[model samples]
Target: MESARDKRTGEIVDAEQLWIINPVDPMGYECRGCSAQATPCSYRPENKVRPYFSAKDGHNAGCDVEGEVALVKRARKQRVTIREGFPGSFPNRLVLRDTRPVSSPDGSPTAPSSDGGRRTGSNGSSERCRNRHWAAQTIRPICRTFINYPFDRDLPLVVPGVTADTYQHVFRSLKSDQVIQYPEPRLFYAPISWKASIADDDRLEIQLSYGEWKERKLTRPYRVRMDWTDWSAAKRNYVSREIETARSEYMTAKKRGDKEKGWLFFIGRQDESDSTLFHVDDHRLVCCVVNEVIYP
Candidate 1:
């Protein structure tokens, strides 16, 4: 059997630790002896150990591979305690997430009131509700697809610059696009600037993944995305129109006051000529996306 010293207990053991080093960030784990950390390298063995805890005590258990079962259980217990006060004095203390199962008592909640009158959470936690009446405006009924667009407007947009001099202007142009417009109450911003290789005869493509305030309206980890693309700018004027449209999106978002948003961008040239340009065409603007999509 393969054996190694246990890290936490510092005990020499026959059972090994199944450390689950992140596939993306190898540096997540380190050698306790050498104090050397692992980086992203294909050289490491395929079965890198990821840390996990489970039944079968000691090192005998397969641990985390079974999934984060323990964590999920804890979440359920916490939710229950919050929604149905933990057998105690303060009934009002119990609170449920906008998406909790059912209240402690299926019927109604009555908390001791200062004035001696009973207070019921029949209406629930109204203010903190995800769909709280608190909105810029009552959202107009919208298609589910349309409503699911990426929105990151509350944040700033950060686009990397090309030339120190022209960079600002170009950035300003793209900066304007990241803001969220009216129809959708959500706005998005991201700093997108990366280098990529393009082959000849290949069409240029840019993928923009954005996010919005969570669906339930909880500011937690809720977000959406929009895939904007334009194959070939067959009609030069149409390409120009698309650019104008992208620019227009920024203008519209800015006017609505979502100006501080940021977003990402990539430039790649086409290879229809049988030669690898690698760089985008100066005459033709990037056409990976067309038209600004708005969600109401």
Candidate 2:
């Protein structure tokens, strides 16, 4: 599905927006088509199937982004193929792959032979995502520096498993006359453990343990706050939840007589502040990951 409204929050979420917060609580969302409850069917980062939503019941007759429409669109694009291209100026880049359907284990296409290539099986959701799609993948690159514009050329330092497309899509979505450049710093997943603290100024800072931060080559132990307006309600809520969860885990571990430093992950953007301070911003361009997860 292209987009759906959140049943709980009444927010409109699209496929591009869903990628950041994969494995979300399925019950919180519903299909925009029929207003039926929706379940997110996202592929693993390594999988080719583009993440999508499926109606818990079935698609309605008037669904715009599903069924035949989706099939026709997928069939027309057929495949995304990227060839070796010139390397650009920006050394580091985030790589995003075009979403494709997962192939069958038998190495055959999964599009149903019945119904004249029309998708089948449970509202045809599975069929739509899987059938008649080519296996070829394309890698689109986005610059990692804190520049106002995305790099027109590709680079060697590509961040693996980070599905970020060229900034063109994001820029188009923002529809802004000017945008800040976003810096691509290190990205850490859940296993690293993240800790967050709120200062009196309402600045949200996240950090690792002092020793760990030093070992990781972090010049500063803490991340400064981005402008509050840069955050989406969804992103703010998720950050709050993650912070609370981290605190809860810390207390639980302490009660168990285990001493451990909580894990800390970076949020918002990392911009060039004063030479002494590590600067970060919360604008959509700077915090691309958070923007997708939080915004519609």
Candidate 3:
């Protein structure tokens, strides 16, 4: 599972955030749907795969997680329009909290609430719950949804500091042909180039696949320069590791004949002087996502 409920803190945490914990509690996680015991996997730095949670034994009868996955898959196969609304639940807003309460060791184990895995409308009806939207703690889930539901890009979204309302308007793709000035900030995404990137103490610059090419060689590609000047060593490493892991996964899939591409997503502003460059500071606002084709 991509997310699980923390028994100690009564909070739903994304699996990617496990690295921030000094020592993860083995018995502190439970399924967000069935409240079954969950085990964290591939969370260590040595693990190349992305971190996720799995049931310790098996999920209980009528686990919503499986149903939710099925619903998403079914929705992906359909042609969705903005007037009809999204067929499944999705995160509509990005909520970036400055600080979170620390989990107490002596705290009582908290079970997942009735509405933990799903959201209900004001009427509290099952039909209304189908199109519910939740707030996301990180941009990773938002990026996943963006890639999964390409047909529903017109769905409503709320990203702080961004003026755009729909997913299609909020996410801007960097053009490879020419550099253009962006007056408004946006959530930018670009395909990662296989070329070598620049990493230094002050910042890390990553080359995008889209750029000016000369005889099949990338001449002037747009780049994202992450300023880790105020970030700790661990934080910097986390960001770098995520990008590497995504690239590795994409390559592995490609070798197996899967058409996949590693894409970088970040909420940043384009440089005024250099239109080919973007500036990102916070690690939380940036993530690497591998786009995969979902077969019905």
Candidate 4:
């Protein structure tokens, strides 16, 4: 599973977050859908595979999470409309909470459900639940939904500081080596260029795939500059490790003849002086995903 509920705090945490935690609690995780024990896997720095949670003894019968995966696949095959709403559950908003609460008023974590709290209709077709949208603690899940449901780009979304309402308008792609004026800030993403990335104590400079290419060499590329001057050592290490892991995953997929690319997603403003440059400071606002056409 991409995420699991922390029994200690009742907060649903993304598997990728394991990198940031100095000491992970071995027995503090459980399945989000059932009372099954979940084990963290491949979370060590040396592990080549991405981190994820696995049920130790398998899930209970009729586990909501198990059924939710199937529902997502079925929804992907169907068409979506604004009137009918999204066929499956999705994180409709991003909520960055400074402190982790024990639980919400309903005694449930704010993390989104895999199935969007689905039910069956008279004809046995999956029907939307009353609570369709859920809150997300990180941008990773939102980015995954954005990539998974390309056809449903018109779905509504709410991100703090961003003016756009729909997914289509919220995400903006960086064009190659362009210094165009950006009147408004949005969640921008670009393919990572492994050859031109820099990581140091001062900051991280990442070159995007889109850039000036000549004789098969990228002469100039769009870059993201993350200021780490005020960040803690642990926070800085987490970002560095994430980038390295993404590069490794991308190379492994290429060696296996898989079509995969590493994408960097962040919500930041364009450089007023250098339009090709974007400055990001918050660690929570940035994420890296490696996939063929979609990501988790």
Candidate 5:
């Protein structure tokens, strides 16, 4: 169990709180399950083990800990599947507004056209919502076929059990189509530069470059939190090592005045907590170093 109720205070006690309670000594907390005595348990941080409460009696009948079951359910909800012959076989009709770059009176950033509505041809026009408002001075709407991608709230776009060849095919198809853009409003993805330290939210900070975002400048860096439990043990190890190596290489390249910049590709639901910032929680699906992705 990751949490247990305090026998004395009647409050829920987490593993970190109990860590300071001196596990070797008697602490006034016990497992909420079965009323058995509980102890705080954790492995070294490098071991990447999630902390949990352990009963003195070991495994008990019907412990109700949810642990792995909860994780599986969470991952299942966020899973994304791009079927074989995805875009080619299944085409989507999207209405894109012609955006003209116009400076504000005070030379502020340009505003994009409000009409970037999308619809599905296979399911008919009513399958998705359309943006209603638009300006009079706009170009004729250009209709294009786009691949429909599934995205989950607060979760990254993960393609489970997908081969690299399939991913490459999808990426190449999206790249070839000039009209296809990243998901908007509820979803977004971009190339970013990472900061060494985490932000106040205890998440990593990443910066999006200019001209990437249409509505906002994204001048400030966004925060991201990686949920390692969503990933398989082997993938977690690989991603960690690759990140370190990529960061080192990026720093070295910068010092040498090379134009090469290490970019991380991230796709996830934007954070509603801040108006100007975005958050990434799905590291397995939509997160990767640009070089690693392009080369691999």
Candidate 6:
């Protein structure tokens, strides 16, 4: 899901989505949210059933940019190039994490960009960020995406496994590199040593979001806590409370039959460090956050 960023707050997840030209599967698509011709290949041709960009109500009718279409004949083949391309340009970019350093498995060096893809900053250090303390996350995912909940799609489940090899194994088995990109950042899951009370049985709830919650008009930052301790009644209660506030809104909409709006499953983590540094790998279970509204 695309997020809006608060520039003043040191770059919150600004939900701006860009239409990425799939190096492979250029012709294989369904629109990415609304029809923007600049990202004509983002969605399939069938999405433009009505033949207009969007109606006043905002239901997309077709691609927004036309005539100067630059979509490739195939997307997956050159998908990596698009990411590692020119360095200064691309159709669209969604920033997932700004200046965050994630440790490598051996904790030796900074980890490379999540997938095998590479990027080159002007200084050239971005080419292999595994050594650097920060990574610039730009995601070009499907217009209609389900990062976690509806795992039915071939979408990579970033939060469900362990081992450094897990990422490569999952990405390699997938049919499309375009699949490498998604509607949202791949679900990053990690194991947490919390006890059974909060996550008794396999049933658990977690909240996934990019920025800090705030009062109306961005009054103040809302505090988020993660329950990684052994399952205690108090822990369960706290988890339940977190669910009610963040996940419940989307759950209610989805379960109560609001199809237009979908939810993104995010592994919840207690950021003892800061709001942006979500230690998802050590997380217990999953949670949902109904992100911003999107056009189909």
TM-score of 6: 0.25
Q: Model 3 compared with the native: what TM-score?
A: 0.83
Best-fitting candidate, measured by TM-score?
A: 3
- Report clash pairs, candidate 4: none
* Candidate 4 residue lDDT tens string, 14-37: 888887876888777877666578
Per-candidate TM-score against the hidden true structure: 0.18, 0.33, 0.83, 0.81, 0.30, 0.25
185-273 in candidate 1: lDDT tens per residue?
11122222122212233333222333233453313221111112333433333333333434445445657777322232323322334
| Backbone-clash count (model 5) | 0
Candidate 6 displacement at residue 167 in angstroms: 11
- Whole-model lDDT, candidate 2? 0.38
User: How many residue pairs clash (N, CA or C atoms closer than 3 angstroms) in each of the candidate models, in the order given?
Assistant: 27, 8, 0, 0, 0, 40
- After the best TM-score superposition of candidate 4, give how far the Cα of residue 113 lies from its true spot, in angstroms: 12
Query: Which one wins by TM-score: 4 or 6?
Result: 4
lDDT, residue 113, model 2 = 21
Q: Using TM-score as the measure, what is the rank order of every candidate, best first? A: 3, 4, 2, 5, 6, 1
Model 5, residue pairs in steric clash: none
Scored by Cα lDDT, where does model 4 land? 0.75
Candidates' C-alpha lDDT: 0.25, 0.38, 0.75, 0.75, 0.37, 0.28
Residue 23 Cα positional deviation in candidate 1, in Å, after optimal superposition = 50
Q: How close is candidate 2 to the true structure, as a TM-score?
A: 0.33
- Candidate 4: minimum summed lDDT over ten consecutive residues — where? 109-118
| Cα lDDT, model 6, residue 78 | 27
TM-score of 4: 0.81
Could you tell which candidate, 3 or 6, scores higher by TM-score?
A: 3
